[model samples]
Target: MFFKIFIFLLFFIQSSYAHELRPAIANLNIYEEDNITNATLSIRLNLEAIIAEVDINHSNTKESKQSDKYESLRNMSAVELLEKFNSKIKNLQNKIYLISTNSNYNLVLLNIDIPGVGNTNVARDTIVDFDIQNIKDEDLKFFWDKNLGSIILRVNSPNNEDLYSKLIATGKKSDWFNPKNKKEVDFFDNIRSYTHLGFKHIIPKGLDHILFVLALFLLTPKIKPLLLQVSIFTLAHTITLFLGVLNLIKIPSVIVEPIIALSICFIAIENLFTENIKKTRPYIIFIFGLLHGLGFAGILNEIGISDGLFISSLISFNVGVELGQISVIFLSYVFIALLFQKRLWYRNKVTRPLSLIIASIGLYWFIQRLFF
Candidate 1:
């Protein structure tokens, strides 16, 4: 039963290219065409997931009942996917809400750019454009439906650059913003929102990260060694995550992912040999942590950070990640370590087998990421 369950998990994890359902990012630009105000909206989203009506709340399409439908849509060519979208244009229209001067505007389809079915395992980026007309000189409010999930929204005006930007929650209306005026955003709100996102990124969505943390746990349940390694890991990742977001250190995911897998494999292999924390283990873990931070930066880059809220959001996200790591450690202690750490056969019966399994999975992931 355990083997079967593990195999099933591996299959789903492999299929989940993005691993998480990232919030769609919408950029709206307003301009005057012959004295008439017109706005163009370009939103980046996973069209296949939307078309299949997959429940994004569960992290990825593989977790949905409509997973098969999503796969079929995901593999469609650009033109083929456009046709599928047209079939449900009305439903799609209702998903995005735009209000100006208390008047609602219907978005007219402009164009869609869908990439070819390249690497069907990875989620494809589709840019859909729409034109919004009949804008008044009042606050514009945007709302994304619960069915459509969350969205990161940005508005730009001819007179002002980056007029407004916010991460709108599903089914919740945004704070009103006018293009002509400068406004101050709530500081605490940005912190609270991103902290939640950062936590979510690790707990349920970040499978690779979870496994890496578990590999650390399997080393030993001793508080001093465990705490020391985790602290070093956290410090190193924090440094790189900040530098990565600033574009100071820019390495593509292709290089970073394989190294991350190797790190997992290395730590698990070490566990099989060492009964306690090795003298050089902390330094090695620190290096791996730096690599993992680059991975975290990729997610932040996708979500985007407004110039005004950069520091607060970044710090909050790191805090959330730390909290997630702590949660994983706490649970492992309660369930496995507390019960088994003191057993005479603990090292031979528990840690050895688990470490081997982790090492195997890590090696498999490394090979898959490198060649496939």
Candidate 2:
């Protein structure tokens, strides 16, 4: 019965193609010259995704309804698409909200550029530039349109030549900033933001990490064994996460992702043969955790940690990841181990069966990532 259920889930998960939760990037350049505060905002995003978000008639339009038209837009030259995008400038402007200490500033569309023709399988970058005037040098708050996916805001001050960056969701504004002086983000605020980033990565977005943790849980029902493994895994990943972020060690995602998937498969396969935790299991987990840490660092590298608060950001994010991992283990204990650990059929029906399903998915990912 479990084997049949597993087969169905494997096929279902593989078939579903949901929109990826990739982050869009926005670069904000703020500088003051001749008693004038000038701001230029350049936003890069997936063109099709933005169109789908803002176009009210998109569902009924050919771009959304017809695959061929969508492909044409995707493959259109950067200049060609920029011309088409000109019509939607107002809609895009309405989505980006900016406010200064003295007054709210309107973003005027300056220009738009698409990098190149993109395809359905690959996302293309569409860059939109905006001009802002009538701004004071005081604290400024900025936000992107909520309809857009997650956005990573990079704020740069040409006057001082300093860089500050943060990730913000739709409708959420960023931290206040002054371009003239070194902006110091509060320690607690830094912790709060990065912690949320870490937790979100694990709970909703970190499917691969979730599966890896689950594979460890299936190895035993006892808390002692689980805690020992979890502690070792956490320590191992923390070491490499910091190392990778500092650029002391660099491993390309092409290699790291496949290896991470293989680690999941290895653990799940081992569970099928070993009922008790193996003496070498912790050592194996420690190694796998090192790879997983690099994965975590990859995310930080993308969003960027503020230079002023690098250590705080790193520690807070790691703390959130640990919290996320613990939550996974606790939930598994309640829903799986505590509920059926002593059942006569638990080993054959639950543990072994679930392990096989996880193993299958991991192996599938391994092959897909490695060869395809």
The TM-score leader among the candidates is 1
* Model 1 agreement with the true structure over 1-372: per-residue lDDT tens digits: 446655765676666645357788999888888888888999999898889988857677778999899889988999999999988877888878888765888899998899998877778889989998868778878887788888888888776477778888877877898756544678998899889888888887776788788889898999988898899889999999999999999999999999888998899899999888888999999999999999999888877777787899899999999999999999999999999999999888778777777777778788878886
Assess the local accuracy of residue 312 in candidate 2 as a C-alpha lDDT between 0 and 100.
Answer: 91
RMSD of each: 2.0, 4.4
lDDT of 2 by residue, 166-259 (tens): 7776557788876555667778978998999898788866777888899989988799888888899999999999999999999999999889
Q: For candidate 2, list the clashing residue pairs, or say none.
A: none
Q: What does candidate 2 score on TM? A: 0.83
lDDT of 1 at 47: 93
In candidate 1, position 220 carries an lDDT of: 92
lDDT score at residue 154, model 2, on the 0-100 scale: 83
Off by over 4 Å in 1: 1-5, 16-19, 32-36
Residue pairs in collision within model 1: none
Q: Which segments of candidate 2 are over 4 A away from where they belong?
A: 1-4, 11-18, 31-37, 54-86, 101-127, 131-136, 159-163
